[model samples]
Target: MSVPPENLHPRSRLVHDALRAAGILGEIVVLPDAASTAALAAAALGIEVGAIANSLVFWSDDEPLLVMTSGAHRVDTAALAERLGRGRISRASVEQVREATGQAIGGVAPTGHPAPIVTVVDEDLAAFDQIWAAGGTPHTVFPLTYDELVRLTGGTVAKVD
Candidate 1:
């Protein structure tokens, strides 16, 4: 069973608000257990792991770049940086993740950040009709289409791996 939106964690409530503001119709679903990793989320939802959209933060030229990638593949940061014509891309630290997104590492949502982040949507995610993304908490997730995700995050669609 899913909890009411008002009863969600404060961080999740921010995500819920962001989704509503974006006109996304999907409701956040609170899982029975924490789905911190893509594999765990896929198993919990009984969906293909590739359908899980992992929200990852990377530091590029000392700025935060949000990369939403399919769970089935690892992001090739070097190739991605070259494609973006940016400097080296490195994973953000835990503190940096929270400072930039106002959420923890395992539960970073595409939206609801303290400020706008430069975002990239993996081209592979478009293969799935429905994609699941974290809802600002380990126990929460929401559904979205690849187009909706790109629009929501103002992301550039690219091959991330």
Candidate 2:
């Protein structure tokens, strides 16, 4: 059985409050684990892999770039670096991740960063009717339509593969 929506983790509660303040209406749901992988999350939620919105933070030189990618495609780091006109692209360290996004590794949400971040939404994600994104916790997720995500994050739609 799943926990009630009102009984959310603190991080997820923060996410919910932030989303609402941003004028976004979505429902947050929590699971049992950090769910570091989209496959694991999809399996647990019984949703298609394509519906999982994997929030990935990449270190683009000295800046942090957030990519909301679909579980179906792998991000090409080198290509993305070239596309972004960055010298190099690398995964962010745990500290860097926390500092940049104001959230821990597995719980990072697309919004609610202490500062603004350049965001990119994978074009592949548009194929899904609804996508599940991290709710500031590894085990928490929220439902969003593809267009809503693009609008909410002010994200550029790109072919992230």
| Model 1 Cα lDDT, one tens digit per residue, 96-138 | 9999999998899999899999999999999999999999998
Clashing pairs in model 1, backbone N/Cα/C closer than 3 A? none
Tens digits of per-residue lDDT, candidate 2, 1-161, equal 33454687777777787778777788787777667778878887899988998999988867988999998878998887777677787888899889988888877888777887888899999888889888887888888889988887889888888
Q: What lDDT does each candidate get?
A: 0.95, 0.83
Q: What lDDT score is found at residue 7 in candidate 1? A: 96
- Model 2 whole-model lDDT (C-alpha atoms): 0.83
lDDT for residue 11 in candidate 1, whole number 0-100:
96
Clashing pairs in 2: none
Supply the TM-score for candidate 1: 0.98
| Model 1 lDDT, full chain set | 0.95
